[model samples]
Target: MPTITTTDGTEIFYKDWGTGQPVVFSHGWPLNGDAWDNQLKLVADNGLRGIAHDRRGHGRSTQTYVGNHMDTYADDLAALIEKLDLRDIILVGHSTGGGEVARYLGRHGSERVAKAVLLGAVPPIMLQSDTNPEGTPLEAFDGIRNGVLADRSQFYKDLSVAFYGANREGSNISDGTREAFWLWSMQVGVAAAYDCVKQFSESDFHDDLAKIDVPVLVVHGDDDQIVPIAAAALKTAEIVKDATLKVYEGAPHGIVGSSYEQRFNADLLAFAKS
Candidate 1:
């Protein structure tokens, strides 16, 4: 029910709970602050203020027709932090949210931030090029765009399976988890979701990663199907000076709130306390 109006007048919905040093969360693409519910409750229960905001055009935030790129996403986050006058905050981001954190620190600086965490995040770069040939192909992103344009609901449902590793063999993912992912995905505006596909896939965070000077915890699932660990956390950890890398052997992309939630919560709490 709480909201912050960005400079552009976009109403960004947020959830702030408990009291202590703040641990701010940024959700992934096509998802909202609710995606961090488990982590937020965990941090709040442990005597920390947990805050998460729905990016513009996602969830309860104003579904604007423009400003769906990473710069705007990062600016929106900065606006939230400044409006709340939050300091000594630990910023944590997952999937696309990770990119947001990186850009925020890069564009806005780390004057008020204490630490940062990136879980199954897309950063450094995710698209293949002459210099970064291991990145995902542009055509793959095109396929996602086409799918969303065709039947957004079905596309989200199908993506949820892979997003949480439900489609993988021997995966113990539950039906509810997949259902939640689909519901969150559907809450995103059609145009915003489509534009984010390009933003997350094409945006390069090389400079952003380099700009981060605070302690960073880079956690990734080796078996991640959505944003492959090789192109994301691995490179990210290497780029950020003195970053701690924690790899979950068989965990999938949605490790933040799925079966791996316990492990993530523990790591996040430990880092926030450290």
Candidate 2:
């Protein structure tokens, strides 16, 4: 098992494949690096190296009693990149991982990065605030927290329906699909899983987005129920200086391994090479 030890001694498990310009990936909350398997396979087959790390306290990483927030998350990413001496990198992030990418660039600088992609990402902030009144209500996030504390197993299983739009009309999502989501989510440590709800919901990324110097590809499903396009992808595209936004009509938050898989993979490959 490949891993990188953070400054604080967290052993972050990672998958590294292929050999070319590197594309480092970050996964969403409550999921390990394995959530990006499809993307990893696609990228590696196309001659680009794909690297994804399980965040601390999630999956094979250390389950620590401290640092379960964005700052530490970004710093851990930086430590990984530095320790591995990776450069001219393309960073891809999904959901909370998008915030991690933004925070990583803002906090540590993107001197090593070449380009970036944010897919179904949460950014600019998810919780409603005075400045961002269009954001999701605090009650919704509170409900997420309640669900995590009340019944995490059931919560992830239930969340899979909306996450993949399985409940949508004419949807063909399978039972195995939902079960895969549950399995990925269950790998997270309870403390990290619980604390990440707040991290993903409330971490403001306006300044961080503004700080991004590399070209970005922002992809989102128009019907994304978890991280709504109106609040996340659209706003992130607007904030990032050079971003090309792609909206998949009628698509759900989880696009990889779905009908949108080929389209997304092509776009990602094109972006990485561009």
Candidate 3:
């Protein structure tokens, strides 16, 4: 279990495998770097170095009662990258992890980072406000917060369906998939999970997005119900000057794990290479 202690003393467990150019993956809320398992295997076999880390309080990382915000997440990642002295890194972040990626690049990135990818990312602010009129409502995030505070287990279980778009018509509700998602969610602390709701839902990333000057790939599913493609990915492409958008029709939020795994992997590799 390889780990790097952040400035805040949190030990972030990470996996650095393979060789050649490194592709670092940051996972979504509540889940660990294991969420990028599909990506790691594919990238590693294709002659690229693949790395993924368990965010503090998620997976193998130490669970702390404090410091579970986007800035902290970015800072911790920056520390890891600096400690390892990684270069030509391709930063890939999904869901809340995308916020961390944007903030990391905004605050610390330079010529070292080759490019970035935001897949079903939570960014440019998720909660609706006067300025972010197209974002999700604060009440919606509050509902999630209340549910997690009430019963984290059940809340995560139910959210699994929404996150994978299992509720849609003709959607095959896989018990195994749902169970895996629930287990992943349960791996994190209730407090960390709850705090991350605000980290992903309320924290603004518009300024961070504007600061990126590298080629960015935005991969999103049109049928994604957890984080709508319109409000999240599409808006992100609009904000990032050098971003390219790839919209998958009828695909859910977990595009990499869902039925579109082959297509997703191929497209992602293509984007990374190009």
How many clashes does each candidate structure show, in the order listed?
0, 0, 0
lDDT of 1 by residue, 168-218 (tens): 788787788888889898889989999999999999999999999999999
The root-mean-square deviation over C-alpha atoms between each candidate and the true structure, in angstroms, is 1.1, 1.0, 1.3
lDDT at 131, model 3: 79
Q: Measure candidate 1: CA RMSD.
A: 1.1
What lDDT does each candidate get?
A: 0.92, 0.91, 0.87
Please list the residue runs of candidate 2 whose C-alpha ends up more than 4 Å from where it truly belongs after superposition.
Answer: none
Q: What is the TM-score of candidate 1?
A: 0.98
Cα error, residue 248 of model 1, in Å, equals 0.5
Q: Which model is ahead, 1 or 2, in terms of lDDT?
A: 1
Per-prediction TM-score, please? 0.98, 0.98, 0.96
Q: Tell me, by lDDT, which candidate is best.
A: 1
> Per-residue lDDT of 1-274 in model 3, one digit per residue for the tens?
7999987789999998788899999999878988888799889999899999999999999898899988899999988888889999999999998889999988886567999999889887788878778788889999999988899899989998888888888888689888888888899988898899989988888889998999999988888887887679989999998999988888888754455667778877998788
The number of clashing residue pairs in model 3 is: 0
